[model samples]
Target chain A: MTHATLALLTLAACAPAERGRTLVIAAYTTPREVLSEQLLPAFREDWRRRHGEEVRFETSYQGSGSQSRAVAAGLEADVVWLSLEPDVERLVGAGLVTGDWRGTPTGGLASSSVAVIGVREGNPLQLHSWADLEREGVEVLTPNVRTSGGAMWGVMAIAGAADRRGADPLRALGATLARVRVMDKGARESMLSFEKGVGDAIITYENEVVVARRAGVPLDYAVPAQTIRIENPAAVVDAYADRHGTRDLAEALVAFLGEAPQQEVMGRYGLRPVREGVDCPDLPALSEVFTVRDLGGWEAVQGRIFADGALYDQALSLSRGQR
Target chain B: MSVRWGLAGWAITAGVALWVGALVALPLAAVGAEALHRGPGPALAAVLHPDALRALALSASLATWVAAVNTVGGLAVAWALVRWDFPGRRLLAAAVDLPFAVPTLVVGVLFVALLGPNTTLGRALEAAGLRVVYAWPGMAVALCFVTLPFVVRAVEPVLAELDPAEQEAARTLGATRWQVWSRVVIPPLIPPLVAGGGQSLARALGEFGAMAVVSGNVPRETLVASVYVLGEVEAGQVGDAAAVSLVLLALAAAAQLAGRRAGRWLGAA
Candidate 1:
C-alpha cells in the first residue's frame, strides 16, 4: 500500500510536465457543484463544437484563500474562480494574473450572493437581524475568518449591522461569537453543522441556504435587513495560461460563466447574477444591502477590521474571555 | 570486530544522508528562514502573540491529557491482551491496531457524527451541561482517538516478554496485589510505559486533522498549534505560520529527546 501510494504520488509529480488540451481551473469549494454539474459540461460541449476537438477540463477546489495561495505558490492553474476580490488582488500582487483582469464582465465579478442567517425549522428562536444572534442562550455557527472567505463575510455582516445601529462593532461581533458554539473551517461546514442540529443559527451565504434547501434539507434562512452583498471573482492566470497556451480557452470559460444562460444556472444554484436581469427565485429582496466598497473596500477594511489587534481579532479574543 | 567501508556501504550511507537532508533538513531550514528572515524580533513577537500563545497552551494541555489517558488506557489494554485467555482475544488485539490504520480525519468525523447534538446521547450530555463537540472534551477525545495506538503498540512487546514466573513468585511470597504490582511487575514496565507515553505526547502535540474537525477552533479557546499554523497560512501570514511552526518544532524536538533520555535512564535503572 505504501509503495503504491508513493508510485501514485510520483506519477502525479510528473503528470504536470505534459499540459495537454485541458483548461485547468482552480476554484473555491462552494462552486464545485455548479461548475462540475452544469457550467463545465456546457463549456466543454461548446468548446468541442467551436474548436472541433474535445477540450479536457481539470479542476481543483479549495477554500478561497487556500486556492489563491496555491495558485501563487505555482499551482499552474489556467484560471482561478475565487470567493472574494481580495483573493484576486493577492494573485495580482503576486504577479500571477498580470492582465487588467478586473476590466472583464461585471467588473470582474462572475457571481454574487447576500449574507444571511440560516435557522432551524419554524424559526423557533425568532432570529431576524444580526442583533438577534447575540441573544442569551442562542448557539450560532460560523466559520473561522482565517480559513474561510464566508466567515469573513459573516463577521463583516455582523460588524456592519452593529456599526449601522450605532453599537460598538467589536463588542457586537464578540457577543455574537461568544454565542457561537461551533466555528467550522468554512461556510459549507458551518451550514452542515447547523443541519446536524448543532446550533440554533448559522451566519452564512444566502446561496448556502438555497443549495441546502434544494438538496431537500428542511433548512430556512432570512435575509437580514442589513447585509453584505457577496461578490466572487473569476480571472485568467496570465502566466499559466500563456505557458499552457490555453489563454483563449481559459478566457472563454470565464466569459461563459457571466453570460446570461450560465447566470441562470448559477441563480438556480443560489448565486445571484453579476449580470443584470437574472433572477434567483430562492433569493428574497433584502431590504437594505451593501458591498465591500461601502464598508470601505477590501484594503481599508483589512487592517482596521481584520489585522492583528484589530476589531475582529479583539472580538475573537473577547469571545473566549477578555485578555 | 572492525568493519571497513566498501563502495556499497558508501552508496548506502550517501542514500540515507540524501533522504535525511532533503526530507528533514531542507524543510526545517526553509521554515527557519521564513520565520527568522525578518530578524529575531518579529519572530519572537509572532510566537509570543496572544493568539499564538493561547494556541500553544491549548495544544500542550490537550497533548498532556491525551498522553496520560493513552498511557494508562493502553497499559490496561496491553495487560489484558497479554495476560487474558478470552474468546475474542485475537479480535480485540487486532482491533487495538485499527485506530492506527484509520485516518485521523476519519476519527474526527466519527466523534462529531456520534456525539452530534441531534443524537439522543448527545442531547443528554448537553442537558447535563457537558458539551463535547466544539469543546475541550471533544478536542481531547479526538486527540485520544488518533493517539490510541501509540502507547499500546510500544508497550505490548515489552509486556509480553515479562516472565510469568517472577509474578507468581511474588504472589507465592504472600505479596498483596499492589505489592506484587509495584515490587515485582512495575519496575520492568516503567521503561516501556514512559517511552510509550512520551511517544503519545509527541504525536498528540502535532495532531491536526482530527483536532481541526472536532475542536470548534475558536481563537484562544479551542485552537491548537497545528490548526493555528494552517490558519496563519490561509490568512496569508506565511511568516507568522513559520514562526509558530518553528516554536512547535522546537518543543516537539525537546519532548522527543526528553522521552528517549528518560526511557534510557529508566531502563538502565
Candidate 2:
C-alpha cells in the first residue's frame, strides 16, 4: 500500500504542472530583441503577480511582409506587432483577427517613430534635408520598398516632403533613389550595411539610430524639418487567442503595453509614445509630420505608388535608364 | 517470362511514388499552375518587365562568368592537388570544399567583412575607384565563392584516375610539357569540366542568400532573378513571383540537361 501511494505521488509529480498558456507574438525583426529582452520579462512578471500562474512566450521575427503572410497562412499567432498597418489589415482580411484592432489602442497605435538620416560619426556630406540625399557623390543606403514596411515609409517621407515643398514628388523621389548605392531587403539589413560603411548616409528609423548609438557605434542622425510619422500597431489576434483560450491574457498584454510604464520603456528603446505627454528626449521633434493617411491611406498608397507600372516602378525604370 | 512485382513490392513502389509526387511534383505543379492561371498575357508581362528582364540578364551573365572562372581555376587547383606534392596541398584541397559546407549567407557576410567599406582593403578599393561591396564585381566574387567547390570536386576524381604514364610517354617522345598537356590531359578533362561548369552555372542562377547581401539588389544593376522573385512575393504579388520562379526553374533545368548531355557525349568519345 505504501509503494502504491508513493508511485501515485511520483506519477503526479512527474506530470506537468497545470497547463500554462503560451502567447506567440509575430513581430518585425527590429523590435524583436527589445521585445524578448525587456518587454516580455516585465509582462511575464506582471502576469504572474496578477493571475498567480506562469506564462510563456514565443516570438517569430521576420521582415514585416513575410511575418504578415505567415500569420495569414495560419501561423496561429496570439498577437502581432508588425511594422505597418497593411500587415495587420492582411490578417483582418484573412479572418484571423475579427475585431476592430485599429480602434482598440490609443489612436490605433502602440508606438511611433519617424524617418531620419543616419550619417557617419562626422557628417561629411553636411546632409540636413531630404534634398541633400540627391546631391552629387552622396550615396544613400535604403531598403527595397517592396519588401520592407519601413522602406516604404522612408520613400513616402521623401516624396511627401517634396510635394509639400511644391516639387514633383516622382522626380524628387527618382533623384533620391538614383543616389541609393545599396538597397537592402529591410530596414535592419540596411542598417547592417550602413554599419559596414556601405554608404555615406542611410535613411532609416530614428529609433534605429538611437539603438546604434547606445551600442557605441559612432553615428549621428538628422531629422529633417518634414518627415513622416511611423506608427507601429499591436493587436490581439482574436481568432487564435479565442481558440487557445488565451483571449483575456492577450487583451491584457496589449493593454499593458499602452500603459505609461511600458510606453516609457518603448521610448527608451527609441519608439515615440502613442499617448501624449510622455516625454522621450531621445526622439527628435519635427516641424511637419505626416502619416499614411495623408497619402490616401494604405490602400490608395498601394495602388498609386506601389502597384504595377506605378509611380515607383516608373521612377525606378527612369533611374535605371539614367545609369 | 515477364518479371513482375508482388503485392508488397507494388505497394512499396506506390508509396514511394506518392511521397515524391506530393513533396516535389506538387509544388512544381503549383508554381506552373499559378504562373499560367492568369493566362499568358500577365505571365509574359511580368517576365518582360524591365526590372525582371534586367535581373534575368544580370544573373545569366554573372553565372556564365562564374562558370568560366571556376572551370579554369578549378582545373588548375585539381591538377596541382593530383599531380604534385606540396606543403599545405591537403589543406588547400579541403578548403576548396569549404564553400559547399558553409552556409551561403555566411559566405556573403565573410565577403562583406573582408571587403566592406569599413575594412582597409575595401577603403583602398574604394579610393582606387573600384567598388566591390555593392557592385557587379562583388556579385561575381560571391557567385565564385559559393560555386567554387562544384568544379574542383567534379574534376579532382577524374584527374586522379588519369594515367601519368601517358604524359611520361609523350615526354619521352620529345613532346614539350605544353604539347603533352594540350593533347592528352585536355581531352579527358573536358568532359568533367563541362559537367562541373554546368553545375556551377545552375547553382549561380538560383543563388539568393549570398547575392542578397553582397549585390545590394539595385533594381537595374545588382538585383538578380531570385531577389526579384522575393521582392514580388513580399509585395504580395504571388502570381508574378510564381511566374518569375518558373522561368528560373526552366533555365536551371535546361542547364542541367545540357550538362548531362555534354558529359555523355564527351564520355562516349
Report every candidate's CA lDDT.
0.86, 0.87
lDDT of 2 by residue, A1-323 (tens): 99999999998755534646788898876786568878899999999988887888889887777788888888999999988888888898899988888776475567889999999887877998998998877899988887787888888899889888998888888888888999987788888889878888999888878887878889998898889999888888999999988898888888888788888888888888888777787666678898888988988988988887888888787676444
Model 1 whole-model lDDT (C-alpha atoms): 0.86
lDDT of 1 at B249: 88
Q: What is the CA-based DockQ of model 2?
A: 0.72
Could you give candidate 1's per-residue lDDT for residues A215-276 as a string of tens digits?
A: 88887888889999999999999999999898989899988998999999998888999998
Residue A196 accuracy (lDDT) in model 2: 78
Which ranges in model 1 have alpha carbons more than 4 Å from their true place? Answer: A1-20, A49-51, B1-23, B171-176, B267-269
Each prediction's fraction of true contacts recovered? 0.88, 0.88
How many clashing pairs per prediction, in order?
A: 0, 0
Docking class of 2: medium
